[model samples]
Target: MTLLGDLLADLDAEAAELRSVVAGLDADTWATPTPAPGWSIATQVAHLAWTDERAALAAAARTPAGREAWDAEVARALTDPASYVDDGAHELARLDPTELLAHWDAARAALGEALCAHPSSERMPWYGPPMTPASMATARLMETWAHGLDVHDALGARPAPTDRIRHVAHLGVRTRDHAFTVRGETPPAEPFRVQLEGPSGAMWTWGPADAAQRVSGPAYDFCLLSTQRAHRDDTALVATGPDAQRWLEIAQAFAGPPGPGREPAGCADARSPHG
Candidate 1:
């Protein structure tokens, strides 16, 4: 199966797992602060719900003209992050736990169904660039995993890691040029090779070392660092090449403003070796 196919399959499973957790939460627990600053468990779930709904809209409207329309619609649909956050909090707070879980479940299923209908090669317009359907699905999975991690950490719960996050790590490595541009630097010529360790204790590598710099390290580390879900110092990645190292320093898997993220506050729960 294609990378996107693999990611979506994993997403389906993860989404279900998230629902199960949320379903079991008490109202007090729903208001508990997630690892993400200022966001409660309910808000975290709402953010995912928003993303899933947005992705489904993007996926279903893949035509050139349709994409333009979709962009305009979303632009109109969302006000600003502050306002969006407020709306999300309100929506989640108002729903019963069962209804909230159902809403999240349905939104994810919609995204998954749309992803299943398209191949990786099917082109669609993302915020600034065109992406294959597979690329889009990978993006969706990455977002889910990142936010879900917030929920997991807040509850002091540990969810099993999966190979799906490699897609996120790859995106972070591949977006070095974009990151440079965002930083007001000239885009570098060399592409960077990415090597990360997956959750299964397997090594996953991508890119060409000859044509690009090399980004080699544990997959979970790179994924966490890139998503701003974990701090860079908390991970064991060593970017050997100059450009590769630079990419790691400012890597971002998601497209948006730079984040105010840091490594985990404490090293007490540093990653333990997987059996």
Candidate 2:
């Protein structure tokens, strides 16, 4: 299989994992608040659905009319960058739970088809920088895992960490510069070693082994940190240098404004899920 095919397969499996958990949810359960402030389980799913649709549109913009539609989306996003995403999520979350799930199912399916049909050499336009199809698929997988973690937390499910997170882990490493750039800081001039222990007892690593700056930790914790799903203090990550230490405090794989990371696990208000 091509790299895009491999990534799409991984993305489908990741999305399915989250879907299985929510498939039988009651309306009230769907409305359950997640750790993200003011976002419900349904909202999380809606965001995913909306994003998939947008990504599909990007993939399909090969003609003049289609490119106009894509350009319009970019204009709209730039109009009120702060509220564009939240508004989409809020609008979609208003649907009946069944309808919402159906929409997400349809959207993700369309995304897969569109991406597969897209020319691999052409970049997919995005809220962030343009990305190759494989890069886009990796981003989708990362978000699915991250938002799924939010839902899992809301439901009190302690899912076992898996190798699927390797995609997210890789993004986390690749986005070290992005993490700094989003904060208006320059990325370090030198490479940093990242050595993570994945669930399958394999070490997933990146960067030069001899680099003085390094981050060493379990892959699971690093994913949570990268997504801002868990507070840095709550993770088992150890940073060897100041630059590496700062990266952990602001690591974010997703594109957008910086997120207000979760409170430390030991905080009084964090005693329960979604607290």
Candidate 3:
């Protein structure tokens, strides 16, 4: 399977997993706060669904002019930052549990179809920059994993870690420079090595081990902390170099204003099925 295809499969699986988790949730559960400070579990699902629709729209636009139009639509959606999550939450809340799953399944299928139709190398306009269809698909996977972690935290359910999360992890590592620049920090000149603890508790390294700067740690922790799925303090990632550590300090894979990005206290003993 192509890289994009593999990513789409992961996306489909994660979305379905989320739907399954939320399927039988009572209204009260939907309103329960996720690990994210202000957002509820309902808000997380809504954000995922809304972003999928937007990504599909973006992928469908073939021509440069068409891509431009799609970008304009995304810009419009951001004017009321919370509207995307709010609309999704309202829609999900109105549906019976079964209907909600049906909607989620259909939405994911449509998204997969949109991704399958485009070649990964086909460039498309993104909210911040131009990216290939493949890159956009990875973005979707990253969001799914990030938000999925939030749901898992809220339910006190520990999800099994998967190396499949590597794609998102790589995205986070690659975006280190951008993350730093977004925070008004000087971009590093030297390449940084990244090591992450995988699902099986094995180390997965990215970049180079002996590079001037290095990021090394358990994969799950790095993934969680990078995506803001969990607090950095919740994990045991060690960045030997100051630049590498600083990058983790404000690392974010998603595009938007800077967030709290700090490691919350008591993350080690926080609720988790795996623990």
TM-score of each: 0.84, 0.95, 0.85
Off by over 4 Å in 1: 2-4, 62-72, 78-93, 126-128, 210-212, 267-275
For residues 6-53, write the lDDT of model 1, one tens digit per residue.
777877877777777778889999989776656788887877776677
Model 1: C-alpha RMSD to truth? 4.6
Q: Between 1 and 2, whose lDDT is larger? A: 2
Question: lDDT by residue for model 2 over 1-275, one digit each (tens)?
Answer: 99889888889998898999998999999999887878899999999999999999998788888789999999999999878988999899999988998999999999999989988888977877998888889999999888888899899986778898999999989989988988999999999999999999899999999999999989999998998888888889999999999999989888876877778976755421221
Superposition error at 22 for model 2 (Å): 1.0
Q: Candidate 1 local accuracy as lDDT?
A: 0.72
Model 2 bad stretches (over 4 Å): 268-275
In candidate 3, where is summed lDDT lowest over 10 consecutive residues?
266-275
Superposed model 3: Cα runs more than 4 Å off: 63-72, 78-97, 201-203, 267-275
lDDT of 3 at 111: 73
Model 3 Cα lDDT, one tens digit per residue, 1-275: 97887888887787777778888888888778776655677767766766677777777788677677796887776887655545655666456556655666676777788778877777766566877877888888888888787887789887788887888888888788778887888889988888777777766777766797887777777777767656666678887778887887888887765666544765443421110
For lDDT, the strongest prediction is 2
- Model 3 residue 150 CA deviation in Å: 1.4
The better-scoring model by TM-score among 2 and 3 is 2
Give the distance in Å from residue 29's predicted Cα in candidate 3 to where it truly belongs.
2.0
Candidate 2: residue 271 Cα off by (Å): 12
